[model samples]
Target chain A: MKAGSPIATSSIWPEAPAAPPSGLARSQHKSPGETVAGRSAVTERAGRARTTKRGQPDREPGLKRANFGRGAGLPTLLLLPQVLILVFFFFIPSLRALTQSVLLSDPFGTTVHFVWFDNFKALFASGEYRQSLVTTAWFTVAQNVITLAIAVVLAFATDRVVRARSVYRTLILLPYAIAPAIAGILWAFLFNPVVGPLAHMLHGLGISWDPNRNPNDALWLVIMAASWKHICYDYIFLVVGLLAVPVSLMEAAAVDGAGPVRRFFLIALPMLGPTIFFLAVMNFIYGFFETFAIIDAVTHGGPAGATNILVYKVFVDGFINLDLGSSAAQSVLLMSFALICTLLQFRYFDHKVNYGV
Target chain B: MVERAPILDMICHAILIAGAMLVCVPLYFAFVAGSLTIAEVQKVPLPWLPGDQFLANLQTAWVKADFSRSFLNSIVVALGITAGKIVVSLLSAFAITYFRFRYRMLAFWLIFMSLMLPIEVRIVPTFEAVANAALPLQWLADLLHVADLWKWISGHDVAIALEWNMVNTYPGLILPLIASATATFLFRQFFLTVPDELCEAARLDGASPLRFFWSILLPLSVSNIVALSIILFLFGWNQYLWPLLFTTDKDMATAVIALKNLIPRSDSEPAWNIAMSGALLAMLPPTLVILLLQRWFLKGLVDSSK
Candidate 1:
């Protein structure tokens, strides 16, 4: 089981060694059962170490004699706080969402009925919910694609610059520190229909750009804000990814008469495939769930619910509208979506690690 | 270094400069607007340069938004979450890596599974849980029919009601956000890299697990802890949704959430200058942290993602 699992193999911490010496003067006492357990643990560590060595070459030499084979009481006590928090906040809430999705309860919860699948049925039957699904797909895809494209170009350029590279990186990465809500407000201010210089400039250019009245404009506004905030994140990853490309490979390509553009496209770009893939997954998750604040601040899912992505819809329904059952059902769906993304990421990470990307 | 093409280098510099300008323009615009008077900001073509009313507008924004209180709230909440997450994650990571214990993998996998459930997905249920931190216990007791058993035995009505609402409190704003799988994984990764010989040497010297962890492992992990702390601090500072829902009281609002309140809701022309000033002020702390510790911030960002 340990040999085949990617998670197990990735953790290079060696198994417990034959019961290590206890506190002062306790080292001499060893029962028969303790010796037996210690021997088995040693053999187990040896077997796991052999497997781990195949995947991670940087395995610590101390893997042979590490972990304290003390009683479980201390470790359990240390882990209790995190475990309790995770249970109360994460696991229990997730399970509650799942259960509540199939149950019909008023906001007060004084009366309840177990109406299995009815909430999900109502959610699917609603036109607005379906539209939210479509809007979410568009918003997520556009935000990620645009953000990644710009980040890739900017990061590539930053990588090639001989001077002030750090300056450019700092400037480009400035937006990452701005919260999504602030980013929304900043962009919304820039594109404010009244008193906005950019809006005035657009009007001068013969474009009718009013996000308040136009659904498309609102959607685009949210997308632009989300992408702006995300670009810095993507840029950071891409810059590191570009920098990690071995210099020798680029030098080899240059020696073969490949121009800068040609070298970038054929060599650096291909090497960045895994990083780009990882960023795509991260950006997708960002757009899907984390853009709620941006939407709330900028468009409020406005103008006709054009910007009402599923996450925001969940918020409005669950909190504002107090439709508990339907919101819980939507939450379940969103959780499943997150699960799929996580699974996809793990699979990609496993492949990347195994193939030494 | 590959090839000296001055023109190409200049072009790359130009594109980079242009891209940087594009990224910075909104922030620049925010500053410009914040500096202008309301009348000036309302002009057909807003001023491109900073005006002398900057301090005045900033004062107005500060007073109107009550940023003094909100800023304090934000600082407290951000610090609380960052400290809580780092401490818990460090302890858990140390436990998982240094000690052999039963159900260890079970605990590890449980934390790993949390990566799937971000607070956004289970917002409502999580809110309900937060509203009554003991809701689950109450439900469990109800499921076991404990109240019914008590009533039957004592010939009296009984109720198992436990209430501990977290809303409008510091813990409400911070605790739920502190259970970070990313931070835990980051510390775990760092711990795995610690040479095992150190653990062996400490043990042979008759030191306890916690002693070795404090004397050696904790000191070695300073850099990782610093990097992770910066990331978590920014994360805590930038939080919007959780704080928005958790804190209904005006005094409890974070600076980020309070900035939104500055935007006028009525049809009356909004105070663009004042609102933008608040936005700029709200963004100052995390931006300063990032700018000052760019190296650690970058390291933490890249390392945590991995």
Candidate 2:
């Protein structure tokens, strides 16, 4: 189900005690003399009052309250402990972090920094910082393209020949199960100089290697590593998109003398565009912050800090260097970058995408 | 009639198989490295073959790295996080979708926006909170009015009863991610697809909200639950950054932090064998989860809605 047609209003909250389900339905239908809108308002309030009574039957009053919680109520209570935990630990801490970035540390617990642009300036002034931002942007764009392309090829290919389609799916998705740190470490060793098996293999093939020393190598390797590690993530999304396309539509296009390429470009691809676009946004974000694993493990920002992405840089500055202020500044920028892109996508492209049911 | 181009298909299959091999190489390397003797592994050219040292290396990794403890620690942390996340996210999704209470949209948006708030950004305050957090052990001690309370509960069930002392426990790793914005988003989107009549029919049948959800909505949404569970479990099991940053207790939590710890120390003090072992150990749960959950994941896309 994509989106439901609303049958009942959310007049009740997180966990209103449930009233009789029948009472709720009856409440929806007006009696012969009752106006429909007026009936709903009265019944909704009555349902609310009944659910609030909790224990023991206020029969008619309690009945109304029960109706309110039945739809949206239960999930709210189940979600409460977690929502509260998140509000404090996740949401509040993030707020505190956000606040710290803006304010100067004071005896009275962080007075205004007042230099609105200073922290941002410090971030921009550092060549390492600017390099990481640009590097991360390039990484996101490149990685998403390669990952999506490779995923499309693999999913389409499997949709044709594979008898054990699910097995291929599982193998491709194996990387998603591995930790980023583990992947980075594993790949780092694979890309090692003079000794790594891959190095030996590449050398035997007369290909120049060394991801750590060359900046281009570092950037490309990070892209490849991200796509390599995340091919399955995109594959899952694309295949879901693929399954959404009706076989009849493709068969009809085939009967009309369309080639596989023509059918794909004209019908399947357009149909899959929404999933693809959603994935582009997903991949873009992953490339922005989530690539630190491969970056850290493979190159540790590299021989010349070439592989340094923003999140890892934040990690180094905050934890390794213990420069909390600059780190907070960098954090704010990273958050803003992500927030802006997500908001822009939602605002502009959201309505354009047709996620198949 | 099909025009089967043998050469092109062969080339494509070759590349696909090669890609598969390429993906497995690191794990192969790790296995090779982990099974070799230290001296063999550190030799001028590393051994490419599986050696006879698997047992010896495993024993050493277990004894020296406390890998068994780390494995147990990971299990607890992963399970705790997954369970907490499932309960919290389900309820939250349920509430946001069905409830018409005050601030429903606001709560939903707050949960929605949270998907983009990187934990790396929140590290400073999270660390501060962790460091100064009231020790559940100390609080219990205060409750008991005993000075040696930490020591008293160090090895018992009572130790787990303390709240703030979760520093090294599974709760520390699980609590922060108990409520996930991503899961909420997914679940809310899924709930939007359900037919309203079923909910209404159940309501008219006298199903309490909880009763209705447990019976009617939840059973229908099992595929969504399964899909969310697999994703959530993998995320929990593979979690590295938060666990590494937040908890100091190496003895009890997911093994990823411990695996990260085992990264070769220096030129003179390498620990690659144990590190690789730990990495492999950390990988098992997620791999197992994926293998088991694929059917459910695929089912969701296939059944969908009428």
Candidate 3:
């Protein structure tokens, strides 16, 4: 379904006399002939007149305006707890990180000195930091591509099967419930060089598989684990998106002599563009941030830091090495990444109504 | 059928079955490893079948990792976060939707800004804030010179520092993590769909805002609440990085973090059976929640993402 799609008023409030002729509700009841630009001026007076005549005849017309609760005092009081939390936890810490990015402080915080741009400059100067930027880019792209490709295939396949659709869905979605750390652990166990069956099989096939010493193997291990956990999430959204595709379109395509594969590639896949884009943005964020637990569990950014994505480096620098300035700088960079992703998502969501069938 | 493509259908089933199997293999392997003895687990080919040492391995892992304490801590933290988020989000959402207040949109936007600052992005500063929970208040007091005023009035210097460190505590674990923009937005969306007539009728009956909310809105939101709670509980339980960094005390560790402790530090071969058993145990609660409340879980997932 499209974002901000109107909910059916009758289904939610069965006892209500009729739909409340308010702003949002009025917009939901437009006729086919009415233009969206002309809706507000036409519906506003009509809705007020209709509602006043049909219900609440005793109430003053001045009070007929929307929003039943009056004044700001009680509402302000109700909002205090959550606002305080946002201030203390989210706003304060984010601001603190921003300020800390410009200052160098001792581990114990007993001494501090302002070093504006030095942390960022040093980060950009270091080959390891530059390598980490490249590493994070590669990791995010590889994991996202692999996960999305598999999820799209599985979701479309599940839609084609009529016998036990939900059974396959539930089975595939089981991984979403597992913690990323546990997923990493399970995969690590399966690929452990000494005792792992999969590793043994790979060795039997003459592939040298050693995650402990091989940087490429270590990166691949984390990538596989992260993708394994992420596929379920993408599959759920893709399945919903696929289900929303019209069967009539498929039938019409079939009537035109299109094969099932051709019909899917031409019709269903195009209809899923918005959903795929949404999933891509989500997967970008997941790969950037949420896969820290997987990397920590599976590779710990090991084998000479080959798997040290940016988020893991932030943790290692801040916690392990106690380089607060550098880590805060990295946090600032990651915050910008989050902001960019969020902006992209909101922009896409704003245009989704136009994209819908 | 439009085309009755049995061959296509068979191919689809084959793809689905293979995908499902691929998704489930790691978990099945974990189970198999957990059921084996240490030596059997270390075998080159590894026993594909279950051995008789499952309970023994589970007990060893449980005792070694101190899961009894960690699981209790996880339960408390997860429940605290779930309840805290629901209460906070419900109140804020109700206020935003029902009341026409000045700066109401401003407040909503301010909370919305938190979507950009996830725990991962602000790890160090959040940790510092939690370590000294009163830091913000202390800063305010310092800026306003409260301590100086008190010292001048009493002719004695008074240390006005407030130490309410939340590290390794339940509030530390739950409160910082409870300001959820998604949950707030979900409740807001649901609240918007509610007919305005209901609120008008409640107001006409002389019911106050809180009374209307408690008596009318809350009951209607049961399904939404349950769905959101299922999602929030799973989110809280599956938390790893936050708990790993915040809770240094072994007694305060979560079950997910405790799974890390089962990994061997020495050069000696790690105990695969025990670690796998711990991993299985660590994932059980959320897994059961997903399986038992699959409908609500999916509903919450889809709704919150929206």
Candidate 4:
């Protein structure tokens, strides 16, 4: 595989190099056949790949096999079940959801109506559908803002405050390490007006409370639960982002006579923008899909449906209602909402993030 | 340079302290409230102290779950899934990072997609496929001659209760639990940091490829493996939806689902106190793991996340 000028075997005939193609003519100065598996395959095929359909010896092995073997191949092997499971379970089901959403199911028989946009129409028409979408959007934005703000503050605080920053960081992440459902459930006990300790404490101090029945109260509690779980993600990003910001830059900012808020806004915040952006992206992703666990636990999107999220709606529709098509329709619609947020992120904040990084 | 302002610093500390209090408040409530009786829990101005009814609540939780068995099942499923994931993800990360073969990108993309896409998208198809697989390790009991072996090991037989669910069988609970793209992703990233020159030199010095990995690569990734173990364990242990789907009755893997069920399907007020207790119970393994492995977990997160 080593690339070099062709050599004459006649010039040095004492002993052959191990596994060398050792019997070459004196000065024909022939180029190597370029058909060898390792060397020429990559070099020649590096440019215009010729179509040698199958069994091409010149074709190199996969990225792993050419470099490592069974022991090294373990990750790929482990990933196989993950891949197979994902493909068979996840991808196929999504594809099925797409298909099922189309064919309207009637009492007599299910038929592939190819209704085209009817499912979507039904989604738009349903009052619950629109309400859920708005609620989900509200949750996503509120959760992201609150989580990111807290995370940034905490991250900066921990970075600069306590001597035991790492310990604090772990403790900060403690809420995250617990299951979302469990956290939600725990918060439920804490925030429940009747039974919750916080409410009890408030009541003991003679403050009547009922988050479950009040719309804003219920919304805030659910958002709080969702946001609390992600505080670690935000904190970690900011911490890492803070770490990546060089001490030299901060010293220079300090040397320039800027207050903490001014320096942060003008200099450090700009540098941390990418981290913030990354966190925002991560927050949207989490808010869209993963919030269901916490939502299930805390409110079950309850009181008067103050916190019913889209994914939870999908769960309700598909699992609870046994209406497959509507859920699939909702899932697609949910994706659009996600897409819009993503686009807004890209269009506006992306520039700042890109520049900062 | 800006002068250090003591007030601003104190304010910052105050805010952080407030945040910390906010974070710890629920955990404080969970244990404190877990001790209250049902009537006491619902009573106006909820009990201020750990009531004598803590044991009663725990008993309610324990029996409601058949929880000793549930706990045993969660452990078995968690352990089974963790082992399966570690072994599988080790192989996966290995295959992905080093193995050169056909459709490697295809494989890589599949894993990446799994990470990107939500699990809800896949649960249905996974259910259909797993349901059709017709796998049975029940005879594993007969093979081992002890349907009671797990019972002996875990000191309880919860699977017997959920046996009719068929998912109580090992393959249903454990086999589907093996897949993890995050581990593969992290491992591959970790592997990339190892010096390729060491590998080349080892191969040149007459070591086989497998030997090169065992001697050179894996030993170096001890920290990474430990980190993956924690993540996979938590993911497996806290798994709510997947196990919920498979275990129709109560076969193992049921605490998370049981907690969901505990929310009072009847419209009578759900038992918040006992539910919190059960949740605290479920959070044990992962929390214990975090407390034990925080050092490595932080290092791993910083290393890979960076």
Candidate 5:
């Protein structure tokens, strides 16, 4: 009934140009005679606005905005099952990990002592943990830089194509679906010294490349493997980013005597700032967490612990060695790092990304 | 596309094709190794071309190693997780979108917080939860003193071991992985984009909420649902760590987990071809899914990230 009425009409017209009711008007805006449904619906849309409460129009600086529902009981009931599951499986376990981080537990988990912050102190003091940190830092840097560079180059190439672009995209992205474990195995097989083709090529080139015995070789191999799967993801995003760049802007730049290379560096690169930032954080997180399977399947964290990333070490300490305290501590640290990245990504990037040209 | 440069276009295709080849090198080796004889694979610099023993290797992996069973196990586990996540998130997304409940943001934040606590970070407690499924129930019983009431009624002492061990079970494999915040978030975003008028129209038609959900919301979100399914299927099918931790029994192992086990542990005379065959088997399902649902899978990835 309220669908086309003046007040209800403005709620649905996402592109309605009327300025949101400011200060005095917000108080007077809710019509006393508005039907219950219309009032609630209007309030829901108003509630989504940045500056105000239920009955006021949102002044958010965007063309698209989500309309939230405003009812009671049934909606709450509908959400309960998922909330229960998440609370049970996710929140409780994470809270347990947080509490466990503060307490020191024995191998069998029978006896526990509340030793607050000692586990964290021990982690900071440990040489192995420190080395893992260094390794993780370097790994994150190398993997993301290489992955982004390759992806940007390839995405630029793919974006330039006027024919069969999807074919190239499909082929490149096939690796994205392959599990990291499988990717690890495949890459490890390629570098397998005995019958591996890449190993044979290295041998033919007189480099004496043996990943099993060489720490640096093992590290680079794992990095390449991890980066291999990720290039597809970054490439897809970059292609999307490149496609989103306005042709008029580039054409205008071209007419201004900018070369193709200059056009890319000056115009396209800056325009893709948000995409690049998003991919950086994602690639870094991927290196930190998701590379565990890759490292496990490929190097098993070593030719002398060379490839043991922080995530792999966490798994080793927790599941393999049963060091609950240290593992829990490591997990807490990992969680903090992830949370920071996620928060930073949202705080600085989301608004910019949404306000796309 | 803005410029017409023939030479640059040739260079671009050349570079892309080369990169594609590099990406496929490992896969090609795996395929070749899967097809070759063990003796041939053992030869220095294994043959790059496919051999005629493909059927033999597949037969060996399937019949002798019981990979077919593991493959079926993976399918069941993947499908189970996908369906459970979809159902759970669908209900929550529906409720959160349509209802104005107290502490609604609290419920939303609680689900959102789970995105940070990935399974890897809380593997230990999660393991304990699954292993001692009755632990929480026991705590509840203790809190509520149900044991006292039971003893008073029965007039005999009873032990509530309630050893609800889920190790090596289908539900165990699926349940822990199903409470995904990402899926819920994606669904909520999609549902939010849906015009509120649809709901109002349904309400005016005297349609019950369930009827509206079944006939209207579900039908409207088919594309989103399909895309999410494709992505979730790959995720479930490709799980390695959880399956490895839980499924100690070879018969209960997922194809990916069992494939890792198939690698010859012995230092002397490894069966490289068999291992390749196992890898090939492990990759087949998800690879086929991605290839077939490439469009939906890509769309889902972009949408979820957004």
Candidate 6:
């Protein structure tokens, strides 16, 4: 259920531990015949003792404690292994990427020279790179719009339906379990020109459906595959958002002579604005990075770079073509862009989003 | 219930059912394709219904494509990455949460920043790092070089260059992918909520920190641990590019990446049904995890975003 609720608190943390504080509180409650002034003094003393015992760190309930205890050696030793792993796998390589972006190395990497910003300049200058950027922007926008629209509709319908609610939920949410690559393969199989069922259906409708030749068709196929996989995620969130809508507002609107559609537009939509914004940023990121698997599986950046999103282009250049410097430069650019999005989300959207439940 | 509109309710139910069915369309095609024979699957209009050749196709996929071996490889790799990530993250989270060490924030932030640079962004340099790490072999080469300083040292003539090329090994497949930050963040948040009195009680009982960690903290954090495990397992299993990059040896291929290899190249007539069967098999572990641990999976996902 509801995040930040007390449901998760019950299982691990004991509500009433067998400690002196609870025992004292119990004794004080039992002896209710004492004078009001004396009882107040005793309670105040207990509160002070409790605070000291709990220690200086947790006094402010909502504030995260910066320090947990006053020890260094053991904690540092405990943290060393993970720190090493992070250094090797994450930090060092990221630093390498950053450095590589500004340097020029031979293909074999035996010789290197400092060519500050040439790689980045070349990346921006290349038409394919610009096209990939355009494609990424288009894909991110199209996928988010389509997924959010359909998911919102589905969530609304699922929320209104009474019978088989859980069944419908289980069915709708199943796609979230499937990997993007697997989702791509499944959709590709469905849209295969010769053997695909959808292709056959389209043929029956007298529409020539060929992704192999047409760039736009290829683009839309990848977009559809990516969007199809993401609908489940947006649907789940929108469902939660819909359930969190205050029932009283809807009822008040209804009593004020508004129909269900009018009430939805007037009351629910405004309240759901934060959730939509949150899902938009999330879906945009998902479309940006995670859809690489879908593109790899379905289109492989397609006939003449039609569905070549930025992430896929990075893969094509780095992994397939082995163009390391350009790939590294592109990686730096992509990381900066994604980092900006993440920073924006945390800075602006995170605090503003209201999880009403 | 707001207006008791019977017609609207019917419409809602209809749309819900229709949407659910639409969501299932690709999966249904995959299932049916996996059931049919290769010939049947390649028919002008692919079969819409399941065929009796399901077992035959599965057997072919499992044996011919070496799905059995790759499936074992996938299990080992996924379990290895999950265990490594969970252990490393848990220890670091434990350190950061329960202790006020010098430079604790530095360590925490270093780990936290890892979340920003996922494999997609730094794939090339990460590949180089993994390739050149040489790990203990580099130490061995150094030790050998030191030994060769003496003229009478044995085996001086032999050149010792070990690349620690973990191209197809379990360690190579797992380690580069296992240094996770989200898990650490999740565990730290959970640990912050834990009542400090419990730690005090444990300390009073003469239990050392490790004992307290093992007996008290570990058990209390079971839900978070399990939720994180399921998520990491799915993440490890679904990996496509990393495994594809690291493993050139066919036997070391994970099931997800290996599924692509099962597909015939464009020039050849493809074994559509067999590839579909492989896809279905590849999907099994994560799908089963999601279905069985749906609540925890959802919770872990939503909570981690927070």
**DockQ metric for all predictions:** 0.49, 0.25, 0.55, 0.23, 0.43, 0.45
For model 4, residues B1-306, the per-residue Cα lDDT tens digits are: 335767766766776777777677778777776777666667766655677767778778878767777777777777888778666666666666566656666776676555444655444434655675422244344666464776778787555321333344666777765766656655655454355577778878988656876787778877667766666677667877667677776745556767666664336775767776777777777888877876555444433331
Computed on alpha carbons, the lDDT of every model, listed in order, comes to 0.80, 0.62, 0.80, 0.62, 0.74, 0.73
- Poorest lDDT segment (10 consecutive residues) of candidate 1 chain B: B185-194
Where does candidate 5 chain A have its weakest 10-residue lDDT segment? A31-40
Model 2 interface DockQ? 0.25
The sequence of per-residue lDDT tens digits that candidate 4 reaches over residues A1-357 is: 111111111113213221233111111211111101112112112211221323354534224223654343454444557676666555665666667667666533454467777888999998988888788789889999999888878866765554455556667878757888887777666777765667677777776667777877777777888888779767755665454344556677778876666766686677666557656877888888877778776777787777888878877776677666776777666656555654544343213123212
Clash totals for all models, in order? 0, 24, 0, 31, 1, 0
Q: Candidate 6: which docking quality band?
A: acceptable
Model 2 lDDT, residue A142, Cα = 89
Model 5 CAPRI quality: acceptable
Query: Between which residue pairs do clashes occur in model 6?
Result: none
Q: Which lDDT tens digits does candidate 2 get at residues A224-301?
A: 778788887777656655544555667778778887657767987876665576678778777877777667666777
Instruction: Compose the digit string of candidate 6's lDDT tens values, residues B34-105.
Output: 898778888888766899988888888888778888889888988998899888888888897777656877
Which candidate tops DockQ? Answer: 3
Candidate 5's C-alpha runs over 4 A off are: A1-55, A58-72, A353-357, B143-160, B266-268
Q: Write one digit per residue (lDDT tens) for candidate 1, span B1-306.
A: 557888888988998999889888999999999999888888879978899988998899999999999999999999999999999999988887777666777877788889899899999989988889999889899999999999999989977898999999998888888887777766765565567689888989999888998999999988778877888899999999999999899999999999998875547678899999999999999999999987778666765673
Residue A163 error, candidate 2, Å: 2.9
Residues forming the 10-long window of minimal summed lDDT in candidate 2 chain A: A29-38
Isolated chain B TM-score per model: 0.96, 0.81, 0.97, 0.79, 0.94, 0.88
Candidate 6 local lDDT, A1-357, one digit each (tens): 111222212222223111112111221321111111111111112223334445763443221243345768888888987888788878788887888888887778898889999999998999999999999989899999999998988888876776787688778888777778888888888888888899899999998888877888788888898888889888876665565455666777888899887777777777667667767888888888888888887778988999999988988888778778888999999898778766655543223233232
Per-residue lDDT of candidate 5, residues B104-146 (tens digit): 6677677777767778777887888888777777778778778
The residue-level lDDT of candidate 6 at B68 comes to 81
| Higher-ranked by TM-score: 3 or 4 | 3
Candidate 4 structure lDDT: 0.62
Candidate 4: lDDT of B119?
59
